[model samples]
Target: MQSCELSVIKYILFTFNLVFAISGIGLIVAGALVLSDVGEFDHFMEGRILAPPVVLIVAGCIVFLVASLGCYGAIRESYYMLMAFALCLLIILIIELAVGIAAAVYKNDFQMTMKDLMKSSMQRFENSKGDRTAWNNIQTKLKCCGVEGPTDWPENTRPVTCCHATREGSPPPEAHHCRSAAPQDGILYMDGCFYQLQEKAESASKILIGVGIGIAFVEVIGIILACWLASAIKNKGD
Candidate 1:
């Protein structure tokens, strides 16, 4: 309510404003890349419209705009502005939460397609007509995730980083290596299993969002609260 606290709020709000803006810009760029369908699915532009990359960018834009409002409201000290920002943020947050829940629960095609990518790539190596060199080449591009046991090959990138290839020929033994996040985006696993079963990445991500969305939501709420309290303080001072 005091000028001093208001000043502090303004400073914090500005910091958040910058973060939101940068994040929004990055997501939007990445989303456009997905929508463009540059890699394997170019013809299926319509199908890619709401994929994670696009969806994330859209959400980022919304949050960025909302955080911008909070900054503006704090700088201008306008209750109307704060209220409007809070309402918009509430609506978007609800929508995002609903979509995220649906995606997590449904086991959509994205999951299957990504899984198939790994399966098909490995198949190429398996069915390579006994050409030792060709199999080695295929193995080069192939990525093995968490392995059941120590990969017969020596370690390349050790302990919680990206992936590596197999030695000259034998079945690319199970991985002794591990990863914190899947080398590929939107994919992660634990031990030898994939993330889909446990939703370790998905559910963990959701939990993180669950925690984060609230804190940001509260910050917006706090700005509104401060504005209201400021108004009351002003009136009382009069």
Candidate 2:
């Protein structure tokens, strides 16, 4: 390549590398959060929203390496480098398309989940078949563990009869909180957390996608402009 051509390639490759590197980092960070208890990941993990941990790591690796290749390609003045960068971008684009389609397939699930969430929220207080004292007692008793449970007791929490019938003389197992179906309640809680996490993941995915698409489009447009400019320069030189 001529001097001006080399400079243009350098610039293009640099920009490509920077863009993809950010994309890779964002994906990896999002993935890591999925495995973490740091936020509302339970929402994402519940009801089949869980993304395999390995998949995120692998996606991160692919993005990082592909971006690095572009960076290295520019400095080395190797056409092979540019080809590798192109291939990597293509792979990311394909992966994004696949994942996006998968997300759409799960739309019914998401809708149902949202409905459940809202219904649960409103009905928690409305379903008191008996005096609310039992709920307070259970909350009081549970506080021994130095933690608070969900404020709005779900419907599955045992009815007042269950709590009222329990004799003070015979303590039930630790698993049986007064009027509470802890296991089923746990699943409900997990579902809520999983839902929230999916939202975050989907949002992050969109951002990465938008950035990747913008960069790739620029590269394509740059290629065309470069070619036309070089042709016109050549004619002028003649």
Candidate 3:
């Protein structure tokens, strides 16, 4: 009966490890997607903004490696290996929790940072060709006029990109009018890009927090299973 129970537990552990391994891959993919999305606005962001995705990717790699160890330990009935796996899982759980907490705490500060960066970018828009191109691309793509709104641009100097397209894939009629301090009603985009970009950043941070907390629960279960199996193996030896 003891032997049979041990066999069942071992298989159960193996199955759990398989799921854990796949989750690690999912984490990597999730991180990569977030990173790619944020990369589009890299010109408008600071280095610290990349931390969450990068951390997720690194954590995923570590989890993958640890899960393999768990699988091997379960198959071999190695008490030491199982204990080590539990210890690693504990470490990972702590890390995930820390990241989730930090992300939640820093969210407000992140908004302020983004606002300052956008203002700085706008200030540099004229003298820096790179900034000019980036601003134009963002204005057109986001369908927004400026950091705050159309008036954020210097008087009578709004770019055509700030103007709404007259029809699909066609330029706005009388594009020159966009340069006027005040274009005709509905001729220019009224919203600011800052809020849109802020929303995206916040969404990404939420993803990080969600994933971290969700995966931490899984890791906790794995840790308990590993420790239980390790204890079982020890009892069998006794």
Candidate topping lDDT: 3
Predicted structure 2: lDDT: 0.49
What lDDT score goes with residue 100 in model 1?
Answer: 64
Q: Which residue pairs clash in candidate 3?
A: none
In model 3, the runs with Cα more than 4 Å from the true position are 167-169, 173-176, 181-184
TM-score, model 2 to reference: 0.49
Which 10 consecutive positions of candidate 1 have the poorest summed lDDT?
144-153
How well is each residue in 154-188 modelled by candidate 3, as lDDT tens digits?
76556778887667897684646887736456778
Tens-digit lDDT track of model 2 for 4-102: 775675776577567767867766775665555322323213444444333555676787887787677666655555565666666665665676567
Per-residue lDDT, model 1, residue 130, is 37
Candidate 1 on 10-33: residue-level lDDT in tens? 666566656656655655665555
Q: Which lDDT value does model 1 have at 104?
A: 64
TM-score for model 3?
0.92
- Model 2: CA > 4 A from native: 34-48, 52-57, 110-238
TM-score of each: 0.46, 0.49, 0.92
